[model samples]
Target: EAGVAQSPRYKIIEKRQSVAFWCNPISGHATLYWYQQILGQGPKLLIQFQNNGVVDDSQLPKDRFSAERLKGVDSTLKIQPAKLEDSAVYLCASSRGQGNINEQFFGPGTRLTVL
Candidate 1:
C-alpha cells in the first residue's frame, strides 16, 4: 500500500512568477483536498474534489490560485503571478468519503517561497 505523492518538495520564485504543484492521491480514495498552511498557522482548506467533481473551492483565491483533479486521480495546483504572501506549504489530502468519521490522509506537502 502506497501513500499520496507530490512533486517538487521545495520551490522558490520571484513574487510575480508562477508556480505549480502536483499530487496523486491513494487508490480508491474518493475525496481529494488541497490546503494552504502558512507558518505558525493551521492548514486552510483551499479546494476539495469528490472523484472528478469539485465539491468545494470557496476558499481558493480565484485571482491567482487554481486546482483540478483529473479523472478523479491526479491533481494539480497552480499560482499565477505569485505574491510574497503566498509563501507557504501546499498540502494534499484524501479521504474515502465526505464525513467527519472519514480519516483524511495527507501528503508531505510542497513548500513555496516567494521572494
Candidate 2:
C-alpha cells in the first residue's frame, strides 16, 4: 500500500562536489527507473532495471553518473564532480511489469542545486 520513497528531498552543493540519492520502490513492482528532469523539460530516462538486472542505461553519463538496484528493491543514484548543468530533479519510478499497459508510479523527486 505504500508508495516509493526517496531520501534528502533537497540538496545543494558546489559545482565540483558529489551528490548521492536513494530510492525504494513500491512493493511488488518488478521494474524500476531513474529519470532526470530539468526545469521546463520532461523527464529523461537515465536507467532502468528489471528486478536486479539492468535493462537499460544508455542515457546515463558513465563518467559522472551511476545507479544500481540492489536485490530488486532499493536503488541509489550518484553524481560525482557534479556540474551546474546537473542541477535538476532526480525521479524514481516503478511499474509492475515491462508491458506498455503498466502504469508507473513515481516518487517525490530529489532536487539538486549546483552552485
Candidate 3:
C-alpha cells in the first residue's frame, strides 16, 4: 500500500500569515486525523474525522485553525494569521478504524517555521 503523502515538507512564514497543509489517507481507510507536535512533546490531536463527519476536534484551536475532509477521502488543515508559537510539525495520520486491529499510520509531516 502507498504511504501517506505531504507537500513542501517544510515551510517558513512570518507571524500572522496564513498557511495550509494537505493529507491523503490510505486507500480503504475510513478514519483520518491531524496532529500538531511541538518540540519535545508528544503529538496532540487537532481533529479527527470518521468518514467526513468530525468525531473529535476539542483540541483544535478554532480561532486560528480549521480543517475539512471532502468526499470522505483527502483532507486539508489551515492555519490563518499564524502566531510565533505555531512553529511546529503538523502531522497527518490515518487509521482504518478504532478497532483493535487498526493502527495509525503517520505521514512525514509539514514542518512550519515562524520567524
lDDT of 3 by residue, 36-57 (tens): 9999999999999999999999
TM-score of 2: 0.97
**Pairs with steric clashes in candidate 1:** none
Taking every candidate in turn, the Cα RMSD to the unseen true structure, in Å, is: 0.7, 0.7, 1.0
Q: Tens-digit lDDT track for model 2 on 51-114?
A: 9999999999999999888788999999998999999999999999798899999999999999
Q: Which runs in model 3 stand beyond 4 Å of their true positions?
A: none
Q: TM-scores for all candidates? A: 0.97, 0.97, 0.95
| Tens-digit per-residue lDDT, 9-89, candidate 1 | 999999999999999998999999999999999999999999989989999999999888778899999999899999999
- Candidate structures ordered by lDDT, highest first: 2, 1, 3
**What lDDT score belongs to each candidate, Candidate 1 first?**
0.94, 0.95, 0.92
Worst ten-residue run, lDDT, model 2?
A: 66-75
- Better-scoring candidate (TM-score), 1 or 3: 1
Ranking by TM-score: 1, 2, 3
